[model samples]
Target: MKRLSLLLAGALLLQLQASEPSVFGAGNLDSDSPYGLTESEKKIVENRQNLKNTKRKSQENSAQLQSLRERIDGLQTIIEGLAEKTQENKLKVTELTSGEDIGAQRDAKIAALEEAVRADEANIASLKSLLESMATQVDAINANYVSKDEFNALVGEINAFKRDLGKTLKSVSAPAAGASLESKSSKELAAEAKASYNKLYFKDAIPMYEELIRRNYKPAYAHFMIGEMWHYRKEWSKALSYFKESAARSSKTSFMPTLMLHSAECMMHTGDSANAKKFLRSLIAKYPASGEAAEAERLLNTL
Candidate 1:
């Protein structure tokens, strides 16, 4: 019975030693037993663990790489949009520059057109003035051929020139309100003198004419008309004095020959016979075909 109990104890110890090799490494087991576990089982377990670790690491790296790629794509999209916007701005600037050039050209053309128009207006005005002057000369020449028609035409041209000159004078003159009272009065007297002469009332014309002469307002016609009035009045000496004054005042007036004839007559009537003959001879020499010349010849024959 003792031997059996010892055997059972020994058997239990052997079982404990075999299980210890699995709990600890082969070094803790009996040195005589070289293998700790089956080689194929160890290799299969290590390969499985290595495969699991490799799969976990691959998953983590793939997630990180996906995030970086998404960021790079987003940056690329932003850069592309910036490039497109810059191109659009460049086009707009180009269009604005082109528009400015067009505007400058248009302004230059407008200024040139305005200058051309003004030059044409001045040229047209000069041409019209030349035409009117030529027509006046032609009408004067035609007067000898077609008396009444040509005379009327000439008068019409003279009236037109007077009207144009009056308008020009008004434009050139100082403002009427600023004119002196004396100037205004002289103009009125001259107008009245002209009206009286136009009515053939030479007596009524005299006082106004004298007033204009006193004012020194274009006194040539005033002196000539006064001399004519005195001659008609048969005041020989007075007529001669006024006629001499008229002749001295104006050389080109229609009154010159008439005044000379009257002076000669006055000299003859006043008994200055030698002086009258000399004056008559001068009149005939100066005005060969004039009415004064005829009168002088008649008077000389009588002498």
Candidate 2:
């Protein structure tokens, strides 16, 4: 038992010597034990180092994800701003196009109106020329045929016929209350006569005007118009007679200055220079600011 005990103690001392390092800073005493650790302890240290590397990698991945999210948010905001700007551009384009269309329409309307005004002016000029031609043709026709005495007789017969018609119309259609039959008839006759004269229907116009004169209504103007017709025919003696009568009855009318001028021209045509000069001087004295006064001054100088 003492020898067995001694063998066990020797085994224990060898184990302790193998576990401890030398005090001279030498390596492990036992060559079979690497780094003086057991196999299980080395395995545990390798597992702990592996866990730390995995944690560091995970933290880096998280930071990268946060940066990507911020970049995506900035890009989205930029896209939204671009969309708003595009809409504003579309509205501006629409307004400009609408204004251009309205201006084009307005210009077209103005052009059409101007064209119509030009057409109306042309039509009025054509009518005036046609009227003047008709007047000349009537004067030529009258001078070619119809003696003065026969024409006068025809006018008298027409006047008689008109008087008979007037009486019949008065009986057929009575005048309304407060209406003057005679005045209305005279006005109607005057309008018809003037219209006939304007249309160059002298044969129809003369008798109607004469009838009005016979009724003692607006006789001065009728006489003056008759004198104008005779003057157009170069009947100097008849023109002078009518002109004198017009002047006599034109005291309350606006036709006196014109009638006086006509009378002066008639006297000159009849080779009465002395009377022409005296009449022209009288016109100048009475109506110095009139167009007739200017003509009289020129004629008197020539005489």
- The digit string of per-residue lDDT tens for model 1 on 35-118 reads 465676557556767876755554444343334333322332333334344444445545555575567666665555555545
TM-score of each: 0.38, 0.39
Q: Give the per-residue Cα lDDT of candidate 1 at 166.
A: 23
lDDT of 2 by residue, 133-221 (tens): 43344344334432334344333333333233223223222333223424558888888777545433344466777777888788888
Badly placed stretches (over 4 Å) of model 1 are 1-188, 198-200
State the C-alpha lDDT per candidate: 0.59, 0.59
Worst 10 residues of 1 by lDDT: 165-174
Colliding residue pairs in candidate 2: none
lDDT score for candidate 2 against the true structure = 0.59
Model 1 C-alpha RMSD to native: 58.2
**Worst 10-residue stretch by lDDT in candidate 2?**
164-173
